[model samples]
Every structure is written in C-alpha cells, then in structure tokens.
Target: MNFDLPLADISTDIWDTKYRYRDGDVIRDASLEDTWQRVARALAAVEAGQEGVWAARFHEVLANFRFLPGGRIQAGAGTRHRTTLFNCFVMGTIEDSLDGIFSALKEGALTMQAGGGVGYDFSTLRPRGARADASDTIASGPVSFMHIWDSMCATLISTGARRGAMMATLRCDHPDILEFVEAKRDPAVLRHFNLSVLVSDAFMVALDQDADWPLSFPPGRTVGNVRARALWERIMRANYDSAEPGVIFIDRVNRLNNLGYEETISATNPCGEIPLPPYGACDLGSINLTRFVRAPFTPDATLDLDGIAATASVAVRMLDNVYELAHFPVPRQREVARRSRRLGLGITGLGDALAMLGLRYGSDASLDAACAAMAAICHAAYRASAELARERGPFPAYRAESYLAGEFVRGLPEDIRTAIAAHGIRNSHLTAIAPAGTISLLANNISSGLEPIYAYRYQRNVRRPDGGLTEYAVEDYAWRLYRSLHGDAPLPPGFVSATEIPPDQHLQMQAALQAHVDNSISKTINVPADMAFSGFETIYRNAYALGLKGCTTYRPGAGRGQVMTADQQPPAKPCCELPGAD
Candidate 1:
C-alpha cells in the first residue's frame, strides 16, 4: 500500500480542502492515497469476515482514480460525522393539507442536515385559490410551499462545505402548472432549487395533436385549459431566458423502471440521475473511462472493454456496501434504502476517452463506442450484483418474477438476464450517468460525464497579492495528451468541444448511453448563445422521441455566470491600459 503517488497540484488542493478525512482540528489523512485508503478501508468493513481482502481491491480501484464515489461519500465515509453516504433522496409524497406540508418540510430539512440532497413532487399539494376546509380560507399552492423548502435548504449547510441541493417537480396538468413554469422568471426566486416539469405522455400526445390541455387539481377539478403547444412554448421560452426548469418524461421514467411494479416515482435526485420513490436514496459511483484507454492519439489506440467491466464490477460491490455501512438521516430513509438497495454506477471521463481513441464526440463512431462501453459496464454490474445476491441475499424488496419483466431488465443481454433470474439481484437499479462536476476536476480535469470538452485550454484569472489579476493557463486532459504526442500541431478532427457539436448530436449520445442505463443519465445539451428559440425547442422533442427519461439544456444568457471562455480571437485591447500596469 506504500508507493510514490504522482499527484497534480490542483487535485491535491481539492483533496486537501474538500475530501480528506480529519478528526477535530487534526488532519488524519495527508495525501490523495491516504484519502483513498481511508475510503477503501471504510467501505470494505461492510463485508463480513473479508474486510482486508475487499479493502485491498477497493484501494486498487481508487489508487489511480479509476473509480469515484459521489462527494457525500468521499467526505462522510471513514469519518465520525453522522452524515449519510447517499448523496441524494426523493422525499415521500407531500400531503395537500397544512399539517402534511409542514411535516414533509421537516423531513427534507433533516435529510439535508445529514448531507443528503432532496427532491419533492410539489404537484401533490392543491393548487392556488383552492378551499381549505379546516381553516375555511384559500390554499397557498405548491409554489409557496416550495419557497419554504428552499429557505430550509439554504439554511442547512451540507457536510461538504455548501448548501444542500433540491429538486422541485410539478405535473404539467396541475392547475398551477403555468405559475410553476413562470416562478423562476424572477432571478431571485427558488435560488436553492432546480425546477423540472414532469411532462406526462398525455401532455406530449396533446402537443403533437395540437389539442387543448386541461389544467386540473385533485378530486377531478378542471380549473382551466390552454393550447398544449403554447404551454410547451412557454417552457421553452423560460428555459431560453433563464434555464431554470428542466423537463422529465415521467411516463417513460416509470415505464422503464426496474421496480415500477413496486414503487411509484414522482421526483428525481437533485441532478435528475436517479428518479426514486418517496424516501428513496441515491447511492452513486463512476468508473473513470479515461483510465481504461490503452493507447492515446495513435492508430493503435483502443478502449479496454474488459478493464472497464472489471472496474465496474468492483465499483458496484463498493457502492452496495456503502448502503450497509453508512448512516441514514431518518429511520424511513434507511428502510427504503435497505428494501431496494438502489445504486447508480456510471462512467466519467467519457469525452476524454473518446478523444484519446481518436473519435470525435457525437460522431457515429463515438456514439457506438459509448453504447458498447456502457453496455459492458451495465452487464458486469448486474452480474456482480447477482453474485452478491447468491452469497448473501437478494434485497428485501426483490420480486424475482416482476423484476425480470421490467423494460430495462428485459433489454439486457441474455446471459445477464439469465444470471439475474437464477441468482436474483442485490440492487434494484444500477448504472446512471451523473454530472460528476467536482470529481472530474479532482481526476485531473477529465471531461465530465458524457459531456464533450468545454475548452481544451483557457486562461483562468487569479487575484494577485497586490489586488491585480494574473492569468493562469489550464489544459484539459485530452489536450495535454495530444500535445505530448504531437507538440504544437493543430488539434485532430477528434478534438470537438461542446459548442462545436450540434444540439441533436448531444441528445443522440445521451440516448445511446440511456439504453443500457437502468436509472437516468445527467447530461446537458450546450446550445450556442445565438441559437434560435425554435432550434432549442427541437432538442427536447427529439429527446422524448429518442426515449430519454429527462432533458436539460444550457444556453449562456444574461444572468448565467461565465465559467470558461472558448478559444477564439480576443476582442481589441481597451482604448488605454489601466494605471496599475507594470
């Protein structure tokens, strides 16, 4: 376990400040390897009588950054903190009455306090202007209640040095659907929440047929009606203007769920990766795809599919163990997690992996490669889970006959399906593509989950001691590899950035991976600044047509903060240099 660890300064800094384990004021772990060992040892302890053997295997996966757990896991595992290892959870159904609403709110606050993100389906609450029999007054609606959850989330800081994240979803047919869609128009509203419109199959069908859609509340009350396409356009406009509310194909998510017969899913974890039932938690991890690339920027470059499969198998076992060892915020959450044993085992550095193999992201070759790689990961994960089921026992909620009949399970390879049928499966759901934002950075700036490189190189501004800014150049993983192989040469055609690709291509890539993913995939279609409204709307429609569970797009706008500037010609220098120059 002792060796020379070649660490990047940026990666080291991120680990030191964010993930490394500490007790009181004492830093117990000093290096990235130390953190890896800590996590490996903690996760392995769940394996009865074989902690050492599994700990060594887990350490091997973590050593070279081949596997990454979510931030909550990285920070809470192997520590004394009373936080949950799961990163996110969908709260149980919120009742329409005042008492029920506040009760759910309390649950959300408690979950957040335990370093877990939460999602709530606000559509359960009655619409605005509805009658309240107990108070004999008007009901305040779902949006108002969402505001209270937002404030609660804002006040509770997560274990990893940030406020908790939340997702608020509303059904499209709700009477206050229009208000929910427009709630984020003011930039200040719902600051801590990510809004998503649960577009049912009925709504999409109505839009396709140019029919009027009813706006209704509970107990079969129709409050109003509007053109379905018109409401769809409003959603498009709001997203175009502010990028607040994303869309989820609720019908599709439920239809394809492996546990659809047992549970009803309304909302998803914060990033829309795992759409879960009430009190259900998201146990997530990612296999670093870039690490499995055998060769880089050469004719012989190839992806090591077997390597990926092995890593994914180990990752599934580690994540499943996480649920056993970690503490839950409440008794109900623990019960839900143990019954189903849901885990999201995904891949990161996909874009970088594609580039290393000399494949352009979004191209046909890249899509095929992504599909093949994801298929291998999913198959291996399922097999591993089945093996675990045989050794220990299937999850409490496992329904062998009903589970095998699920849409996703039925689509798996014959061998995998047979294995599951014979041995049962430990985790209800496996394989989701998470954003992996910080973990990607920690992994030496590899391209994030299924996203093309934003920029190969960019100048970051750093404040100097004298209060002036200094420019520091940052290079992406693929860019660095390409430069090492062919110095100063122009980037190959494979070096396609996010903005260079079309929006449709992004959806295609997502759909390709989504086919094998049992849960959802977290992907953002990056549209250009000058893209037309019509073009933007097509992305969502295409996503639905492609059978994706959800769609999210990012278009740089007025309020959107700039992260990195693309490599293009700079504007002319200022008319006169500032007085603080050398």
Candidate 2:
C-alpha cells in the first residue's frame, strides 16, 4: 500500500475539483492519499468490532488506486454529509393514479437531492387519452409526466455537484411506445433523462417475422398495431440522428436475473448498467486493471491473477460495507437496500491493460484475457460474499434454492456455488461494468471500463491562473508507456484505438465479459460516423444474439456533441476570467 506512485498533474487536478472532500471553506483532504485515508477511515468505522484493522486493509487497496469506489463514495464517505453512498436507484413502480405518480416524483426528488441517480419504468402509467376513472378526464400519458421529472432533475443538483441523472424506460408493448421512442427527437425535451426502449422478446420475434405488433395498456388491452420492423426502423433512424434512447433487452435481462423469482427488473441506472427492480440501488466500485499488469509491451507480459482476485475480494467487502453505511433518502430505498444488498464490482482500464500486455483489444487474445480476468473477479467476489455471509449473514431477501438456480449462479464454479449454497451470499448481484469515464480520467487517463482507448493522444484544455487556457496532450496510459519505452516510434500492432475496431468486435468483447458479469454493462460500441443504418441495426441484433442485456453505440456526428478529437485547436482565454487577471 505504498502511496508513492507518480500521479499525473491532470489526474490530481480532476480529483481535487471533482472528488476530493472539503469542509465549508477549508480543504480537509488535500491530496489523493489524504482523500483515500479519509474515505477508508469513514467506511471502516462501520466494521462491527475491528475498525482499525479493516481501515488499514481498506487503505491498503485504496492507497495505490487499485480499488476505486464510485464518485459518491469518494466525495461523501468521510465528509459526514447527508448523501447516499449508492450511485443510482431504480424507483418503485409509478402508480397510474394522479396522486401515486406525483408521490413517486417527490421520492425521485429526494433521492436526487441525496446525490443518487434514479430510473423509472413509465409503462405502468396508462397511455395518453386513457380514461381517468374518478376525474372523468383523459390521462396525459407517462411521457408528459416524465417531462415533470426532467424539470425537477434539472433544478436539483446532487450533493456531488452534478445535475441529477435519470433513466426513463418504456415497454415496447405500451400503447404510447411509439411516442415514447420519438420523445427525444427534439433535443430540448427530456434533457436530463436517458431514455431506453425495453424491447420484449415478443417484439423481437414479431420484428424478425415481419409481422404486426400490438401496442397495449392495462389488462391485455390492445390500443394499436404497427409493423414491428417499420417501428424498429424509426427507432434506429432517430438514434442515428441523435445518440439517445438506447435499447435494453428487457426479457433477456429478467430471464437471466439472479433474483428473477422474487423481483422483476424493468429499468436500469442512468448509464444502462445494473438493471434493478423497483427501489434497487447499485453500490458500485471498480478494480484498476492496469495495476495488475506485470510487464509493459513485453513478450512475457502477464496479468496478475492473484492480485486481481485479492483486490476484488477486498473491493466486494468495501462495497458491501457501503450498503451498511449508506443513507437512503426514501424509506422504500432503504428497505430495498437492506433486502437486496446489490454491489457492482467491475473493472476499469481494461483496454489499457490489454495494450500493455501487447494484445490488441477486440482480438481473440484480448477477449480470452477479458474473460479470464472477469471470471477471476466474479469467482473471488462470490467467495468473499459467501465468507461475509458466514459472518454477517445473507441479504434479507436471499433465497438459497431460487438464487442457486439463477443462470449466473449456476454458471459459477462448483466450489463457489457450494459455498454459496451452504452459507448464502451477502449480495444478490455482484458485478457490472460501468462507464467509468471520470474515474478513469482521475486514474491518469486509463482507458474507460471495457472500452477501447478512444485515441492514443488528444489535446485537453486546462484553465491557467492568468485567465488563459493551456492545451495539454493527454496520452492513453499504454500509449504513454509505449512512448516512454520506444521514444516516438510508431505504436505497436497491439495499440488498437476505438475507431479502428469494428462494431462486431465491440459486441464480442462485451458478450465475453457479460458472461462473467452477473449484471448488465455500460459500454458504448463506438462506430464510424458513416456506418450504414443497416449495419447499425445489425449491431444491436448481433448484441442480442450474443446474449447481451443492452446495447449502446456512439457515432460522433452533428447533434451528438464531440467526445474525442485528434485535431489540435488554438488555446483561448478561460470562460470566466478573474477580475484582475493579466
């Protein structure tokens, strides 16, 4: 747990501004080590008997940046703030009645205020123009109510200093399904929400057969019918123009869920990871994969499997402690947290780690590595959770017979499965790959979660003290390591960037990891801007075929803001200048 690694200034700056804990006007935690210590101490305090021992263990993994909890845990853990440790929650089903809908809205606000993202399944609400029994008025529909939630989220900045994040999901069979899919066509609408079409198996079947699809509401009601393929085309066309309203294979997600017997997963967190039942929250963290690579661009490069397993075990414990330490904003959320005790322990820097080992991302070799790495993590996580159950007891909602029969649990190693069956596991779901964008940036620009390096190098804007902007060339971790060793020589064949990889490779990689991950993944298949609509459609179908729970693709173009650029631009003055700056 040596805290002597040379951290980049940019990485330090990101932590300082975005994650480091502060008190009023005083800078309580000045350095990354200090912040880690503060968080470790705070989380360790929840340990029943041996706080100091567990605090030291937590600091061991945290000091070297090997294990990173979500941003909520980083900023709020030690600050004694009235914020929740969980990153996001799927709110309880919204009732169709006017009073029930508004009540859910109020609960969403409270959750957002406490710095937690929220997701809702709007299919429960009746379609537009549906009858209101007591009021004798037509219902305005779920989309209209979503607008209210959007406005509320826009106004409430979470405790982490970011605007609230939301996910609005609608079932494909809903009467207003078409309207819901096209709602985000206007960029101004649902600005604060990420929309997803919950594609049921029946819709896919109808789509494949080129048959008519029924759109219905309450009690087997069929309000309209449309050509399934044609409706799917509209969805693709809209996404081609604007990058939103991702597709989630809802039926597949539920079918594979470990808790499927007792819970139904209707929606996911904002980033499309961790599909959860109502009031379910994801207590998330990631293991820095780059830290486990034994050699850089060498013929004998190898991954430290033991290191990965050990870190994952500690990470699971830390994240489980998060459930105990978390402060839920709503009573139902608290109830759900206590019942499910879900934890999303994923990996970051996967692409960089692959590159460092002289393996091209999306190649068969890299895919094998990803599968092995993720398997080790999942196995270790379940083992640790079982051990925890022996000491702290299983989650309240855990049912051994049903849980062991789950697709994911059944696939686990025999030893791990036996242990779980004997003692049960602390958490229902153990793994998810989140879009760890900011955390990866904080970790010295390592490649994001399960995503290929966007570019080898890109210019970044940094504000100077004198009110001017300075441009720094940020290099991907493996690229930086290559340059340091090879000195401006062309990148090796292993250094494959995101744009160079094909869409299918992305799906292959995701499917490989998804096998080991009990929950869904938050990965973007970066496709070329000029990719054909037919090809884009194929990507999602292929994703479903590959057993993926969800598919999100990012094609850089107009309407979709630029995320990465290779071209250099002139440095300009800062947006807001100090009064007396020269």
- Candidate 2 residue spans exceeding 4 A from truth: 1-5, 158-161, 460-473, 568-582
Prediction 2 global C-alpha lDDT: 0.84
Q: What is the C-alpha lDDT profile of model 2 across 216-262, one tens digit per residue?
A: 88837888889999889877877777877789999999999989999
**RMSD per prediction, one decimal?**
5.5, 4.4
C-alpha-based local distance difference test score of model 1: 0.83
TM-score of each candidate structure, all chains considered together: 0.93, 0.94
Model 1 CA deviation exceeding 4 Å by range? 1-6, 158-161, 459-473, 565-582
Candidate 1 at residue 76, lDDT?
Answer: 81
Estimate every model's Cα lDDT from 0 to 1: 0.83, 0.84
The residue-level lDDT of candidate 1 at 308 comes to: 89
Cα RMSD for predicted model 1: 5.5
Output the worst ten-in-a-row residue range by lDDT, candidate 2.
Answer: 573-582
